[model samples]
Every structure is written in C-alpha cells, then in structure tokens.
Target: MLIYHPAFDANHCLYRIVSILHSANKTGVSWSLLRLLDFYYLFPAQLKEISPWPSQISKYKRLLKNIPQQYEDINNSPRVFYDLEKFQKTAVLELIAKGIVSKESFEADKLCLVDDALPPSFIAYMKSDEFFNKDEFKIITEALPMVGLNGPQGLKKRSGLMEYIYDA
Candidate 1:
C-alpha cells in the first residue's frame, strides 16, 4: 500500500484546503481547479498571506483525509490540463514573482513528487480560516489518475490498476 504525502505546492493540497472552506460556507463549487479560484476568490485580499498559518487548518486537514484510492493510468494529464488551465499562467507567475517556484515548470501541469513527507499543520498557515473555511463555499476532492506515478518496478511501463496492492 502506497501512502501519499501531498506536497505544499501540490494543486491537491490547495484544493483540499480551499474546498474545505467552500464546503463550510455552503458555496456551490463544482470545479476541480483552485489556484485560479484562490487568485479570483482569495487573493488581493491577501488571504494567501494568512499569518500564524492559515486558519483553515482543521477543515483542510479533514478534507485531506478522504484520499484512499490508488487507481491510476497514463491519461491522467487531461484532468490537470483542463482543470488548471486558467491558473497555469497566474499561479506560476505568482510563484515566479515570489521567487518561491521556478517559471520553467509552470507552462504545464507537469506534476512532480515531494521526496520528503510533509505534515498538513504547516499548510494551515498559508491563509486564514476566513478563506480556508469560508461559510459560503464548499469543496470537493478530485484526483489526477496518474499524478507522479511510476510504473511497476519504476520501469517505463504502464500496467492495470487492478494489480495495485493496497497496504503494500
């Protein structure tokens, strides 16, 4: 069984945190992408700069606990491409502006892996509960079928998800 430790820069991480806030607020959000939503919905207000850690920690943490599926495939790129297209330019630009991330990697949803594990506690600090747990919005978790996944034995091969061993 493979355990996934979502990285700080991962779209899923932001989505998990933001969606929890949206759900708390009862906001009708059906989209899978969020960084764009963060810019459109939380930025300018500087919600991303939430001090002392984002206040939405508990909520985001709760939403993050929902991931248990291991099903994956090679075509997982579409979900990220279409869902995050709007934010691709903006988020990457912001990262570049902040010097937090490199620009070369932002052109595509080209996913990466975090070698070291990260706990969710630090994530709560990115924004305040106001944006993380907004009362009017709600969040839903989505997966990119093959995000950062390597074929069996790390070989350049694709295999059936049914063969995946849970708790491996």
Candidate 2:
C-alpha cells in the first residue's frame, strides 16, 4: 500500500486536507475551499492580523489547536504550501473558483472527480491508518460520506462560484 508523508509531499497533503475538511463538514454548511487553504497555509501571525478582536483570536486559536492529526503543528511557524510547481497557488484558486478538480483528483475519485472539489478517495486515505488514529479515522470515515459530490461554494455568493477570491 502507498503511504503519504506530509513532510515529503506537502502539496498532496494540502489537497487531501481540503478534501477531508469539505467531506467532513455537513452538506450546505461545508467550509469554503479558501478557508481550507487558509487553515493550511496561514501562519498564526497571519491569523492574528485577520482576527483583531481578542475573542475572535481566541476562538480561531482554539479551532487551530484542534485541527486533524496530519495538520498538527509542532514548530513555531505553521506549515504553508510550497508546491508551486506541482500545485500552483493560482491553479488552486482557479479550481476553487470554478469547481474544477485537477487531474490528480481522478486518483482520488474516479467518478465526478473533475466536477466535485472533494473526492471519495481523498476522504478514504485520510481515514486510513496511514494518517489518522483509529478513533479519528472512525469519526472522519463516518462523517465524510454523509454527503455526495459536494464542492466548496463561494463564501460571498452562498451558492455558486465567486468570480474572484480575495488574496490573503
């Protein structure tokens, strides 16, 4: 069986993380793809800048502390995307804006992989022992598949794609 190491392949890690978050959240209330990217790339300092209010910062900090196992930050700086060649930031933004999955999504979900932002295999691998603990796997596996073929919608519009996603 193939195993994914986030330290070795951060791009795949980001992709998988986004898909997992999207799948795990309930339908119609799923996090936007931009939000997932922020969760992965935005450092604590960046978060602080955006969350000026103490209560908001505290709430976001708590949320960050509870991120999935694969995303646990040990060092001071939070991990950020460094896969500009294989996974260009621009391309990913386009994907989120257009709901177009990369060719890699085919490896994650054969059917509707190109159309939907989240794929079945992405969730499956995340739930596998390769990344998550048994309890985490069980919870993630159970919740991720409750919805089908759902993609992240534009945070502004509430339903369809947004023409532009503001740069962070």
Candidate 3:
C-alpha cells in the first residue's frame, strides 16, 4: 500500500513524529504507539483545504485523499493495517535517518526514545524566521483533533502542554 500526501513529505512527517516523541519524552507521557500511527496516517485529511505549496494548487487539490472513517479499525481492515504499518515504518526510518529519534526499546512495550538531547535541524527549520512567523503552528494545532489525540486523556495534556511552552 503506497500512501502519499501532497501537503507533506517525509520531512514533514518526520518533523511531526519527532516533535511528538520529543514532547512525550520530556513530559513522561505514555503515548500509545497505535495512536501515533493513526495520527500520521490521518494527517493529510486534516488539511484538505490548505495546500502546503501554493503554486501547485492542482497537485495539492488532487492530494486531498479521503480519510478512512475509522482510523482505529485496523484490525478488521487489512488495507488499513498495511497502510498504517508502511507509513509508520517509513516515518520512523526518516526520523532515524535524521537522527531525531531512536528506538528506546523494541520490547513488547516500550515507548520510542529521543535519540538526541539537542534539538534537530527540523526544529530549527520550524523556528526559522521564514517559516516560524508564518504561523504553521496554527495549522498543526488545528489538526490535532483530526489526528485523534484531542481527547482529555489522549495526548492533549501532554502534547498540548508542550505546544504551549514551545510556542512561548
């Protein structure tokens, strides 16, 4: 299953994944691996109206693929299972390649570990005057609910708290 998004590339996905992992590690939150995968898979759908690249509007318009009704119904849907697995692997590989994240423990139950205490270039990229002032954080914040981590006990407290500090 090849799942690609017009609004974001491997860098974009890696940025999100790393940011989540970095925040979770900092906050000591026990985020669910399953929820992380679902968030990445459903991210593109959250930005159906906005194109990351404005010049290529038509390309982005075509890229707004419909999100599955049930992101967590992977067990009953083989296609969903395959897509999520593939996307998660690809995103993780990108994170590793960029040195933003590392597998803390591959055991049956271990959260991902931040590879570096220092911030990655992606974070710098996000903070660069050109992009940072553009309010990309607003888009990311808006997409939180669609990513399915907006519930009170979900990632809102963890990631949201981190975002508040990060934005400040």
lDDT by residue (1-168, candidate 3, tens digit) is 987652236555555555555433332223344333345334433333232323323333333353323332223232433445555558766654655444444233343645454456756765563422322323332233333333433333333221222221
Screening candidate 2 with a backbone cut-off below 3 angstroms (N, C-alpha, C), the clashing residue pairs are none
**Alpha-carbon runs more than 4 Å astray in model 3:** 1-8, 25-82, 97-99, 106-108, 113-121, 127-168
Candidate 3, which ten residues in sequence have the lowest lDDT sum? 159-168
RMSD of each: 16.5, 10.7, 12.2
1 or 2: which has the higher TM-score?
2
Whole-model lDDT values for every prediction: 0.33, 0.37, 0.41
List, residue by residue over 96-165, the lDDT tens digit for candidate 2. 4555444444234321224444566856765563434533332333322332213232222221222234
Query: Per-residue lDDT tens digits of candidate 1, residues 84-129?
Result: 4455445444444554333343334432212222235644553454
Candidate that would win on lDDT: 3
TM-score of each: 0.25, 0.31, 0.39
Query: Native-vs-model 2 lDDT?
Result: 0.37
TM-score of 1: 0.25
Q: How would you order the candidates by lDDT, starting with the best?
A: 3, 2, 1
